[model samples]
Target: MIAEPEPGTTAEPEPEPDPEPGTVRPGGRTARVRTAVLRVAGDVLAEQGFAQLDLADVARRAGVGKTTVYRRWGSVTGLVADLLGDMAEQSLPRTETGSVLGDLRANAALVCRTLADPRQGALFRAVIAAAACDARTAEALRRFYEVRVAEWAPCVEQGVARGELPVGTDAGEVVRAVSAPLYYALLTSGVAPDAAAGERAAAAAVAAARGGVFVG
Candidate 1:
């Protein structure tokens, strides 16, 4: 592990100077640092698992300052939590393809694409393990899902407005429906889930809704 720098001392080499206000720094170092941190965090979680995650190690791997990590995220859990939130936010918004099935396929496809990345998948596994044993991690994971579900729920709401779904259907539950099977496959099968799998999950979820599986 790298030693923590003394307070008020340099941790990494400084850029020559900041750019003028409101002007883009061509080949931005700030963007590089952000990407570097995220890349390092993902790599460490994939290679070392959650229990072995430390801000110092992340800094060392990122070639960034430990102080910056601490200042930004405070702890490994916090860092991972923020990363998950960012990933959720960056994900494409639900497509309003006019039918619940169409919207659901979009949702499922995006999720499949994300979990298909080995590093992202391993990080997810580590987080899932932590969530199983640690309350903080569990809460963070739940919140991450909540954010994602909410982001996609509007499509369900649109379905309701268009009378595609029943009047009493819960939008959040509808959005989560698109994910349940994909998650099951991730946690159980070793198979690479494809767009067809997403279509199956979407069809099943919409079918369940038709059968009152999601009704209160």
Candidate 2:
């Protein structure tokens, strides 16, 4: 028999080979990785609250290596920032519905749908909670809203140019008006922002725009 290796001195066994390619689902490898991170991060935030989040845990649960996670997103805050950006880009673009009221309705409906999503709702709440104490989180949250508002502002500007809204309408405020109350309702009365609430918000926003409440 060959000489036995010294105790604890045998060449370390080579690591097992990684799982085969077919073992991986490729439908959205990138998206899957992103979803995993967000879900894990959101879970951590909800269960232990934001203060206790650990990037290592998130990476482990996401089935991604910590080195990969760190290489892509230097910190938890950075990951959260990218998550928000992904969400913003994935959201529907504002459409031209001819009338300010119609556009507002469509916008309000979209907001309601998004905020009512269990995942989105929880993620948003966690982000808001994080924003309360973290400046970076707060700035990220604000930037997310700004990007969203900018996506819809063109509708208000279009209305103004068509004489549907006052010439000097503040497109930003008009867009903000469409969803602000719905957000308030959801946050305050614990109400589900239903069709009626959305309609009301849209109508209010349209009325404000027509009445020049958004006039600069």
TM-score, every prediction: 0.81, 0.80
- Clashing residue pairs, candidate 2? none
Could you give me the TM-score of model 2 versus the true structure? 0.80
- RMSD for each of the candidates: 5.0, 8.0
In order, candidate lDDTs are 0.78, 0.77
lDDT of 1: 0.78
After TM-score superposition, the amount by which residue 71's alpha carbon in candidate 2 deviates from its true location, in angstroms, is: 3.3
Instruction: Write model 2 residue lDDT over 114-185, tens digit each, in one string.
Output: 778876766676787788888888888888899999999998888888889889889989889888998888
